[model samples]
Target: MTQAPEDAIDVDEPLAPKFVAATHDATGEQVPTRDLSELAPPARPARRWTPKRVVITPDALDHPHAHRIVERVEARGIEVERLRANRLTGVRGATERETYALAKSTMAIVVSPPSRRKLQPIAPSADWRVDLAEGCPAHCQYCYLAGSLSGPPVTRVYADLDDILGGLEPYLGQGTITSRRADRAQEGTTFEASCYTDPLALEHLTGSWTRAVEFFGQWEAPVQLRWTTKYDDVAGFVGLPHAGRTRVRFSVNCLPVSQRMEGGTSTVPDRLAGLRRLALDGYPVGLTMAPLMPLDGWREHYGHLLDLVEAAVDGVPDLDLTAELITHRFTPGSKEVLLGWYPGTRLDMDESRRTTKRGKFGSTKYVYPEDVMTEMRTWFTDELARRLPELHVLYWT
Candidate 1:
């Protein structure tokens, strides 16, 4: 592999740029309103994810949250059944692919206890990750959580969430967000919520994320709750008293790649529309252009993406936009799991097209070669700076 050029975008590099159109009062001072009706987007199509099966653990049978979830599911004419306390009764199929698909469409309601062990650190995203749920139901071909979780791939939403949020009290004022450098003195602590699952996907059934949002809204701390989603389910979240404490980033990519690789999720335009709505409501918003595949005609592909983003968010007042850029990389175990799940997928997981890169815990994954990475990252960072002057790139990895 050749060495990257000196101008290549480095991982975890922080860049803050601003591009707000100025409006002056008679006194020569800038005055702005949070009105976004001028740049309001059209209605975007919504995703309808009805799980094929709903299983409840014995302990969750009488839980309040579980009862509400069951009522919601049953209201839609779906019946629920009970499972053994610590067992998945029937989640198997004849072939590996069939089993994988079945598990994806199944939802398991369980009572998960708070971890007595230390919480996991999610660097470059947040200080500590506190998972409210464990799995996602979206069938994206590039599902990196493929082999990462234990047990079957059933989507599990915890019933014991009060304990989970309660456990974070001791961890505040002591995370990477505030202690990193002199400039981060104000951001007391940060927690990443979507480390293992997309919150919006499960928010509909469980209403657990809505609860978490309320908890963060009332807490009188300098804490920030961060989570990005591929879905545009914000109806349950809007109009909440958030106190500027939550940042919702939308995971997006070029059209061809998103249509081909990501199924059962909102389209790029729809996600941008959602981002516009949330930003209009005064929630700090971000664009998470992740698993960046330098496909054919790569420049035009992502250039169009930047154009859409600019049009969607050009006029919102007091906009605090940030970007998290993540290039595509996959481990061998994930590759195998994905192959079994979607044997006919057209995803580019070829070993020849990627080079080996070592990750945490001595794990190695295949990533684009240095020259390719340098070219793509350089163009993206430069284009983002040129288009959205007020955007801050939190990190690139």
Candidate 2:
């Protein structure tokens, strides 16, 4: 079929832009001149974390707390970029290697609604979840966020503190079925604040956790705020009038596991020292021995870790201490993502050694074998009883 002449198209029909070209005035040669800017995605600002680079969404750029956050972060010589929310989706690498690297180190800042409802329940520790931030800056090899969140884990702090703290009022008297314990005489709503991020890692920049501790302190209701962290910056939290409403649980692993798998986290001693400090200052403290890998001689190493914990809280009379034991488990998807994120990880994720089991969330997970699980349960329970008899074991999973 013959092509229609450019100027002979019907009035209601428009000619294809690609078929028409503007003529150069001087040479009379066809030249293509079309504006494609509207069709292209908006540019995203560069994302970096340490030697920090921060990107804020346009809607949040002018927020009062956003300004304060930017000011504080910039005060430490960090670079902040203000961009629109849509621009964030365009952040990606054209090449394979660059994309992989970008997903590992990029961080962005945006305003998100505070946890107003139980989006998903965080059982065992808290019934409902609260989030001060959405990502961790720590580069732990086995970080679960690697699988849960899309792209590289970028630490994002929401700017609306008033709304976030205000949202907790409705859940004041609510309690999860397993939240109550007779040892503490505490019974009320429980909120897990560090479900997706490490508050202490962002404390210097956002001070969200500090404010949360204070918020829980003066709350009229008997609500309890709980958070866990691998970091040890407890100085700001120690003096808060938490009223035993806030439980600061420090995540500790045997030295060998931490040194091998955890990156950019506080040293074991520093964390224990911080734990001791908080306990001494009348704060309820706990220890989280997570991802309990049954490495060779794990019992000896973990036993020594228990001994260290005992020493840290040794003299703190009437310490309201608790323990959460989590064994090493991985999903197939998580295993793939984690290996991609940290190709050099020494984590023992070999599926052949793990037993397949269905998780509470309907996801499949590879857990330690039954015999090994029994041994671990026996060892840990016995160790807690023998070394730290006063400490409460919340659950073993």
Winning model by lDDT: 1
Question: Where does model 1 exceed 4 Å of error?
Answer: 1-38, 42-45, 113-117, 182-187
Using all chains and alpha carbons, the TM-scores for the candidates as numbered come to: 0.87, 0.82
Candidate 1 per-residue lDDT over residues 42-61, each given as its tens digit: 44335656788988888887
Score candidate 2 by lDDT: 0.70
Q: Number of the top candidate by TM-score?
A: 1
Query: What range of 10 consecutive residues in model 1 has the weakest lDDT sum?
Result: 11-20
Off by over 4 Å in 2: 1-51, 89-91, 94-104, 113-118, 178-187
Give one digit per residue, the lDDT tens place, for model 2 in 1-397.
1323424422113212222112222222224334332322222221123523567788676557777777766655567776746256534578544555554454566667433333456776676788767888787888878678765555678776656787778765455533454643364678889888887777767768888887887786667788898876665564456766778889999988898888878877778776776665566778888979888998899988988887777666457899999998888888988887778888889989999999778998899999999999999999899888788888888
lDDT of each: 0.77, 0.70
Q: Roughly what TM-score does model 1 have, to 2 decimal places?
A: 0.87
